[model samples]
Target: MAAENRAFVGSIVVAGAILVAGSPFLMGFLQKWESGKARVLVVYADPLAGGLPTVCNGLTRHVTSTPIIVGERWTDEQCDAEERSAVVAVQKRLAPCFKRPPSQMVFDMATSHAWNLGPAATCGSGAMTAWNRGQWTLGCQRIARGDDGTLVWSYTCKTVGGQRQCTFVQGLANRRADEAQTCGEVL
Candidate 1:
């Protein structure tokens, strides 16, 4: 009886391990099967209208052309070039701050906040922190709702045209009168 119990437990463990190992492959196969049932739709420019076709030949699914659009289908090379240009622009904007040997934690936190909010948000009231060592830290923040039904304090930042900037949302509203003011002042 003891030997039979041990064999049953071992078989159950083996079966559980096999099921776990196969789950990812099973899920992928199921997704593929479901996708196979989807219908294919074609879209093309009206030939009588002349010029290049509004839709590209390789599109695998539905297409619409209610709005006027231009530009040829992007090739991988063009896409890579565009991506490289964007990275270069970001690196250029970040160069000055990077030279100060900024902490990775600080940079990441600031960048993440800037990515979410507009660049002016990084400088705002909630996101700004003053360290005891005389350093200023900026990033996301938490705030309470005011009588106006708005959160008055929040840390936020933004990147625009490859330039990074941050500010408190409320402070920005108050300071908008000063046209010459810019977030670049802090960096």
Candidate 2:
């Protein structure tokens, strides 16, 4: 009986080891999740919408347009250059805070998230801690909630009495989801 019990225990241990080794494959990544694909991530967060002044993070300014006067427009080249410059500034602010320096795409996404969400949300919140602790996906998800916690991407709005009343912004939520996904991806 003792011999048989020993064999059974050995078999269980072997099976457990195999399961652990194969866990990553089951989870869809070859290893633990950690992504920083800034370049690709930026594409998802910031799409080209023409050379017009836009409001982001409650600041009405044009990254692509200099002076950002009302009704001012910019060339695609100017916009692209300015956007890149803005990303650089964001990267500089966030890079040092990350426990692991993210890949370019991840960095870009985070920068875009900050740009879209707000500066207070980027480094001065749980997202920063998440990035430092490798729980960045969760951090990014939290970022979607905003500083006041008034929004949730998971919830949408309906037309109430023909008035568009909403507690959530679908686009913003999607952006946050993309950021979180990008952050959790394996580089």
Q: Of the candidates shown, which would achieve the greatest lDDT relative to the real structure?
A: 2
Number of clashing residue pairs, candidate 2: 9
Which numbered prediction scores highest in TM-score against the true structure? 2
lDDT of 1 by residue, 1-187 (tens): 1222112111111211211211222212222321223211223442322332332211211122233234434443332233223322332333233223333333333332332233344334243332112242222222122334455434245578999865555543332211112222233
What does candidate 2's lDDT look like per residue over 7-95, in tens digits?
A: 21111112112112111121122001111211111111222223333421112252233455443444434433444455445444555
TM-scores for the candidates: 0.27, 0.51
Residue 100, model 1, lDDT = 33
Candidate 1 yields a Cα-based lDDT of 0.29
Clash pairs (backbone) in predicted model 2: 36-103, 36-106, 37-105, 37-106, 38-104, 38-105, 38-106, 38-108, 39-105
